[model samples]
Target: MPGSEHADRTEDGLSIPRHRVLVTGATGLLGRAVYKEFHNNKDWHALGTGHRRARPRFLRCDLLDEDAVKAVIRDFRPDVIVHCAAERRPHVVERNAEAAVDLNVKATATLAKEAAASKPGAFLIYISTDYVFDGRDPPYGEDDTPEPLNLYGKSKLDGEREALRHCPAVAILRVPVLYGEVEHVEESAVTALWDQVQEGAAGSCMLDHCQQRFPTEVRDVAVVCRALAERQRQDPSSVRGIFHYSAKEQMTKYEMAVAIAQAFHLPASHLMPLTEQPAGAGARRPLNAQLACCRLRQLGLDVQPRPFRTAITDCLWPFLPDKRWRQTVFF
Candidate 1:
């Protein structure tokens, strides 16, 4: 069986079988990074699943459909299932709470059940959010009890429980706001600030300065996910239960805007900071939800994330409107 240790043999003296990995939400920002990490690694054969925007290298599957999820799991017979699909937008989740539950909790539950019932029992990793913490405290450890403030956070917490309920050998990774290579500037919340910066350059712009956020890079999170998969292959019992991964830098959205303006060589005099949550928001967010990464650090994985300024500059470079302006600023 492909799931077994002796599935494939190599020419080298120490032969290792290449495991098949199935990634969900391949088209999304973070999902794309995760799929790329595993797809590029020679140790694993990866197949990604997506909906609406599905294309080559990814199999189209609506996770909400139990039958479709079952078919993918049964046919792919993955040794590892990385569940990254979810209604991640807090406002969107608020608009239709039912739909959020369906995708976040119900769909995750279905995937976990199918993975557990597979012939070899695929190890499942459910990507979660740091929003599970209420943000009242700093450096939340793995064992810390979650106290989510909004529907999105609550739903993700519930998804974690459901995934664990159906699959005992599940690993839950809770990450914070992520930014990385984007198809467009608005694809990621961090990169999206570039638009606001540009708008602020035109006139005054108000940004959230009260809530402290640790914006992590999607590529960094992808690396950690790959490391966990590799650890599971080496020792099935080594990677299980709840874990946390995040960047160490701390800054508010207002500060982030300032950084973005500086990075792109734009004016920030028009930018304003709102120390309180914006009025009429769809949902209430935590003031700070810093996740402690003691576990991953102890596991010998890279816990130090790239500097925010360096990463954000690289991430927004591709979307720069004027090629000559980009050359003038960067060069």
Candidate 2:
């Protein structure tokens, strides 16, 4: 493994066991969470990649650059590659379809091919999205057919398909809204709202829509990735398929906003409830992005779902102000 350091030696001077891992998209929200979990573990030597700013040991390379990606794979010789880099913004993807396809689909395919050829037994875990499914119903499961409503989701789905062809040793993990604190910034939906509350921005409390799906915390999603990595390490040929990672329960956009407000001790009236309408500029969202984790549970990786209130509190507490804010804002 490239980044691994031998801790001890046998009588004959054989090195101790270690696993070297590489993570792409180390700067994004979920990617940062995964990096934090793996980077700090002693058993795993971690290398992270970013397109722009190089953070400490992180490598600077765009995923679209095939030669650069291949060089990193060959040099690092990682035991596992967690692919998270992508053009994630829906609106941006809609506007720049070529860029989105290049980054989200073509780059993923290239990484899978390079990883498989460079490190034959290495496991490749691709981070997917719940947006793949059109939210037509509540609590969609793994077996449920995907009907992506936007370019972002379709691109990710295409990436998943391309990855499977190039890398058989792969696990596709589809997750929902990830919220938490990392790198001193709040990136999740809940945290975004908390920032508004802290600033006494009444608009934060009121922009609720009826359409939304289950929300999963960043920490929980990290745990799932860790478990999947460990599983791959142990068996290498274990069940490989699509897995859903999200809070078990469902919630609407309006209800979710209200819960966040309550967690921050702000009045619900500050929130504005808006009718569920298709996103205008970007691609339309699936009405039911809720994912059923039954298959994931069957694999013995059943993640305990956190309640909405608990999730809200856990996400917003860090951003809560020391003093109380006004509760008379219009909903």
Give all TM-scores, in the order shown. 0.94, 0.86
Model 2 worst lDDT window (10 residues): 322-331
List lDDT for all candidates, in order: 0.89, 0.76
User: Which structure among the candidates has the greatest TM-score?
Assistant: 1
lDDT of 1 by residue, 53-145 (tens): 887668899999999999888888998899999999999999999999999999999999999999779999999999998999877999999
User: lDDT at 7 for candidate 1?
Assistant: 49
Q: Write the per-residue lDDT of candidate 2 for residues 100-159, one digit (tens) a residue.
A: 999999999998898778735568899999988888875778778888989999999999
Model 2: lDDT of residue 323: 29
Clash count, one per candidate? 0, 7
Candidate 1 has its poorest 10 consecutive residues by lDDT at: 1-10
Q: What local lDDT score does residue 272 receive in model 2, on the 0 to 100 scale?
A: 65
Per-residue lDDT, model 1, residue 206, is 89
User: Which residue segments of model 1 deviate by more than 4 Å?
Assistant: 1-17
